[model samples]
Target: MTVTLKDFYADWCGPCKTQDPILEDIQEDWGDRFQVEKVNVDEEQDVANEYQVRSLPTLIVENDDGVVERFVGVTQREDIEGALESAGA
Candidate 1:
């Protein structure tokens, strides 16, 4: 099973801009531990809706054990890393 981090964001969202780099850094730093999937809300509304992303920069962490956790808004990098660690990613 693989740990996948699904990030739902939009180009027009201000907070999403703040979140983008953090997740990018996480992807770079944790390349061996997890996978990052970016979903553009404007271009992929269906995907966002399926994940119930009502806000910008909604992050969903899932694995074979199902969804490990989720975060909305501009989440801190440490919290995300902690969640990944706890999920055994």
Candidate 2:
């Protein structure tokens, strides 16, 4: 199973900026266990709309099955790690 982390964000979103470093740390720790796809809501409105992202810094953890976890706003590292693990990353 391929676990993926879809990060919905916008350049002007403060919370999204806070979330960036957290995700970078996860990428460093997890390595190739999962893939991270960053979507700029302002540039990719269609993609954001498809996911129904109503807020900045929306994170979605998905695997082959489907979406396993979703987070809104700034999320903790541990919480994201837990979601990744659950998604078989």
Q: What is the C-alpha RMSD of each candidate to the true structure, in Å?
A: 1.1, 0.5
lDDT of 1 by residue, 1-89 (tens): 68888989888889999998998898888887998888998999999888889987899988889888999889999999988887779
lDDT of 2 by residue, 39-76 (tens): 99999999999999998889999999999999998999
Question: How does each model score on lDDT?
Answer: 0.88, 0.95
> Model 2 Cα RMSD, Å?
0.5
Q: Which stretch of 10 consecutive residues in model 2 shows the poorest summed lDDT?
A: 9-18
Score residue 72 of candidate 2 by CA lDDT: 93
TM-score of each: 0.91, 0.98
How much lDDT does candidate 1 score? 0.88
Relative to the true structure, candidate 2 reaches a TM of 0.98
Instruction: Return the TM-score for candidate 1, rounded to 2 decimals.
Output: 0.91
